[model samples]
Target: MVKYNCYKPKTEIICSGSSEDVVGQYYQDVGRSDSQGDVDITIGEALQATALTSGEKPVEWSDAAAIHEAEVRATGRKTIMPDGITAAAQSAATRNARTTRDEDKTKLGEVLSNASTKLASDKGATRGDAESVMSVEKRDDPNFTTHPAGVATSIAAAVRLNRRQRPG
Candidate 1:
């Protein structure tokens, strides 16, 4: 059988807001310059609000410490009740764990292996294809038909090539 719990608000509460958020807004509204007065007013307001909401009076001065002690005693939590478990729940959890355990690791290994095989095949195909591709026809290195000597020959060859390529 499955059990479901209903949610209910807490009876006891502590206003754990930052002193700045509480006191700052309070002082700004009260226009208080002194920090002590600001703190006093803020606490008083908090106590009043808590009292009104809980339908109880603030702790008396003499019993304040004892009240706080009692609060502290009642406050702490324990791992008292263990979480619910069922056979179906356990099986679902186990299945999820099994799927997640080596999932990414296995996927990563498969991806890397596939990538390595593809790269090897690509490299072999590229090398073989490159071997068949005709080499660039090596232009006769600066034939220097005119004045076949030094700088003059190279310049003449270059000018001839340019003139041939360019429209007249």
Candidate 2:
């Protein structure tokens, strides 16, 4: 809400706009006033009655108090976001997503590493037998990289190794 002097009859108009085009003198000044007559609407309903037929800053009226109340109502907003960031400082969604992705990748790596170690060190197979089976399975079978497939391949290779070492 503001008071400004207008040109036609030296009357007053109340609105938000530039300080320059104000007809004569105002009780106070805010933004510069140009001949645009276009007032930036802070809200919709407050000025419905005051809207002018035409002119620079047509959204004006003689009543400054009504404009003041309207400004308060129109500009009011709730503070939903956390305080540390201003509107200009807002960031993208990717950083949080990247962090979660990295964590999942680490957990997956640990799971696969544990599975491989367990298969290689299992009771019946020698390390060489386990390594050979794992290598061959990885090369020949599409499912070879899976934990269950590694154990199965290692078991089969150990059985073959055991059979070869026995007396014919």
Candidate 3:
């Protein structure tokens, strides 16, 4: 997140009399004594300088924090850092993560494509053959069913089954 000084035209009632009234307006620069318009905006908005367009993705806070840490390590001068530096780092981190995820997805797609091609080649393969191929893949890749969410889901199911089997 970022803090921005939001300023609007300051208005004043110059005169308040029975016969006539006068008004004045002027724009106040940021950090002026009478300008007290501060707003908090998300990092994405600060970096983009506008609302997200269609199909545009926003930066995640975790990515920003990671980028900030990396910049601090690289520069060795952490204090009084400019917002531009933070914004640029955050943008870079987001792009890097996106690129990495896309690459991983492509790899997974290729694996799936190869698996399907193999299955299609076996024109008379039975359902058991498909199961055998899946078991082999799972055995080869330890991470195949070890995702955090998958582990948690299996744990929850086990707990539920244990409770159902408990003695009354």
Top model by TM-score, which number?
3
Give every collision pair in model 3. Answer: none
Pairs clashing within candidate 1: none
TM-score of 1: 0.14
Ranking by TM-score: 3, 2, 1
Provide the clash count, candidate 2.
10
| Model 2 clashing residue pairs (backbone) | 5-23, 18-31, 18-32, 18-33, 19-31, 19-32, 19-33, 20-33, 37-56, 37-57
lDDT of 1 by residue, 29-115 (tens): 222123333211121122222223322211122122221221222222221212211122233333444564443222211211222
TM-score of each: 0.14, 0.18, 0.20
lDDT of each: 0.23, 0.29, 0.29
| Residue 151 in candidate 3, Cα distance off native in Å | 26
**Model 3 worst lDDT window (10 residues):** 114-123
Model 2, runs deviating above 4 Å: 1-103, 106-122, 125-149
Cα lDDT tens digits for candidate 2, 1-168: 566443222134575655755444343323212244423211221122122211112111111222222222222222312321111012211232244443332221121222212211112333443354345435433443523322323344444555455446
